[model samples]
Target: MVLTRSASRAAKCIFKWLPNEILHLVATELAPTDLAVLCRASRLLKNIASPLLYYSVELSTSSSLISFARSICQSVDASLPNSARLLEVAKFTDKKPPISPRIVKEINDALCRLIRLEVLILLQRSIDYTYLLEHGQFPQLVVFQYLVPSHALPALTSFLNRHKNITDLGFISPDSLKFSTPLSLPNLQSFMGSFAFLSTLDLTDVSLTHLTLLLYPPDIAVSHAVLVNLHEMKMLSTVEVMGMHANERAILHVIAGHLPHVQELVFHHFTSTSSPISPNESVNIAASLETLGELRSIDFGGVGGNVIEDRHMVAQWSAACKSLTSVILDERQWDFKENDWVVSWNL
Candidate 1:
């Protein structure tokens, strides 16, 4: 005779109870309604759900982000060095006043309590970044994505100084950046160079492996010069020029003379010199693209339909970048049609 335990008695068993780990996995996979029900199971369920939710919270608008941040620095439980992760931060932007100075210091103090914070991504939201060096002074930041206000140079420089282990640093979009003091991150790997004013800063000393400049076109000429200035730091991988006139002749010396080491490249505008830049130099077509020998790809940009004179230019690009396997061109012009250029890949 097989006897079965009573329902209440079986429910009381710890092993029989749905494990919080399993619930967590399910919570992530289940519908929001299902997840809410699990959270209501008990305090234990609530605690687990909080981390899964708040640990990587991506908030919405900058104003909303400010409210939570305000509450974080104000919470009676918000003591520095022992405070826990606050949940539900959004990824938005607003000109909310920088966190008050007093709150800034406390938030910094609170972050110090965290023995570890592996990855932190602060998008467009304005922050009390002044306190970052104090708390997010974390030892090992693998990916640090923060868009700093250009005026927050002190805060930015400070963080770079304190957090020496950041592998990927995204300065996002720093407007009117006057200068960059020396950054001492010995282990730094990649950097997103988007600030317009950064061209004046001397970044010659830092070891940068992969660098990108998504800044405006007028500045691209200056930025390209900066890349050429890198001399012989060979670990560089890709170069992208956005919405820029392709022929920035000033770069010929640096690109050809100095940076022969760059392998993959991208282009948007090819400036026509009206006269061949170099007598034998030919119009600066990839067909004539004698420089950047190791280039493998080019990310072409959108062109207005009014311009119909880019056939020879496109053919030159195809012929010049011999190693190019991928060419991403915009669809509006169909200049490729007249040029008899079929890239096999479309927009």
Candidate 2:
């Protein structure tokens, strides 16, 4: 009982400054052995303890996330923070292949049960609920974590659909991670993830204001709808786009049309199979954006010389973008015959 009193005191002290009320728990109840008693040290240190106890009954085979998670469900703490369970579980576990169906279902059920939970990080995990028509909702989800999956797309989609109060969204799944559902995150402002099929993600139509799009050896034709609603949006602040192609030139044309209002633009891993744009090539990139006037900054990466005729096009774009405060280009474009690398802008 002495340990119980100590555990109670520890919980109170740990939460002494926190604005949230600390629900008192018995020391003996929170600790079944000396290791648990020793863990009653500090609040931050307690996260490790909480996930360990909340998810696992036997803390021995913790290297296996599955085993640890199985044990956590048996933890005795009634005050276990439900919102933190996902990350906490992630903290002390290792991933193994040939994913366990039962564990996946259990994690999904736990996530569903946390009606008030607003954050989740289910990396390299499978939480499938094929029969769950409950429409389990998370109206306040602010963050999500999904690594890569062979087929975890449905699990990710279900989580997103249930949450109407989301401000952030993310996913990582198998190649061509495409879904037919229209993503409507009214409050969402930031997102990052990989998609095998860019056609499925209509970001420009969505409310997202900040975005980072990346996937290995990118195929950019997937951005059809997002590229379509280019000029209508006034809230887009930052865009880091990759995998340039003939179609991407169209996307850039639309953005260039609105250049004066943009804060930042970055182009990465751009490779075009077609020959460089000519005077009559008909891809009027800078000409289309004459209305935008200027930009704050522009950065280009991995632009190969073989794909283009002259690097001076960068200078022309900078000249046209009257408000361009900063422009960056790669040093790889320098000629060996002339030590002169070049920039014409005043900035």
Candidate 3:
């Protein structure tokens, strides 16, 4: 299936006439290796692929990080703004001493040149990036995820306050910020962090509308505290509870009590149990759902129980909540059978 020289020339001629938009679309689907090769094909291909090639980069080694920083500094020297929009560093060892101050400075300098950077993810344990915030770098950043030490909280809070554009944030080790007063993020719309950290936050002034809590069968008192604090967020409309725990009923009641306006709910329970839902728990859950007048969707994952026997229970819930449009239990969807008013599960 080898092409002759004339045939190859004809193919190139046809491809050369393709629209730039089509070429950009095709380039986006190419693997990094393929993209590198494509960039060498012609000036137009190189121009189209350059931005995509450098758009999002992950560095896993100190040498690679240093090299990338040097390259970005070179781009700055040439008066060219970096094309990077997302940058991730995944290999910082938490137990080891921090990266050399010199390297950190160099990395900071490189990051400053990225005028369009919108997301930065530091998968390491703790790395101080206060310099970026202090210098007003990443002015367009809208999402940020990082793990930092307790001493970094002030700088982090300052950063959040300065960057009013940030709407989504994840603090992998939120314990660091627990002792500090809740930092107001008027524009923050979604938050992902530990249940303990989220429970203690004073979100009275924040505009949080979505919350994702990572839980591990939190202490009853802690869970109660979280729910009480969450009640203050009157605008919250979506909640996701994810963890391997057996307190589903308690969690659901808390959510229903605190976030009455929640329109979407997702439960990812990884705990395995053969026990069926207790009658009291079912009653409580139904009562809570009844209070969630705006509830529309519920997505359940890793849920196991007597689903067949509980069909009637689900039906009662559907009947009570006229606004409910869809209910997903594990991998099955429950639809109300109009003929008998029974809930039927479908794949």
Winning candidate number (lDDT): 3
Residue 217 shift from truth in candidate 2, angstroms: 10
Candidate 3 residue-wise lDDT, 74-159, digit = tens: 75335334578888888643344567887788887777788788988776554456676567467788888777666667777777
- The C-alpha lDDT values of all candidates are 0.52, 0.49, 0.69
Off by over 4 Å in 2: 1-64, 83-97, 110-116, 125-137, 145-158, 181-183, 192-206, 214-225, 244-251, 257-260, 270-291, 304-314, 331-347
Candidate 2, residue 159: Cα displacement in angstroms equals: 3.3
Which clashing pairs does model 3 show?
A: none
What TM-score does each of the candidates earn?
0.67, 0.59, 0.74
RMSD of 3: 6.1
True-structure RMSD, every candidate: 7.3, 8.9, 6.1
Per-residue lDDT tens digits for candidate 2, residues 169-257, read 66555454666566655666767664443345445446657666654334344444444454555666676665435234445554564
Best by TM-score: 3
Residue 183's C-alpha lDDT in candidate 2? 61
Top-down TM-score ranking: 3, 1, 2
Q: Return the lDDT, model 1, position 218.
A: 55
- The all-Cα superposition gives candidate 1 an RMSD in Å to the true structure of 7.3
Residues 1-347 of candidate 1: C-alpha lDDT, one tens digit per residue: 12232345357655246555665676567654454465577655554554444344356665555444554556454332232333233454444555666654654454444545656666544445556654355665566776666666776676667777677666655353534554556566676655353354345665656765555545644655566556576776665543334443334444445556566555445433222233233354443346667666555454332123334455566576555445454532222444365545444
lDDT of 2 at 335: 22
Better candidate by lDDT, 1 or 3: 3
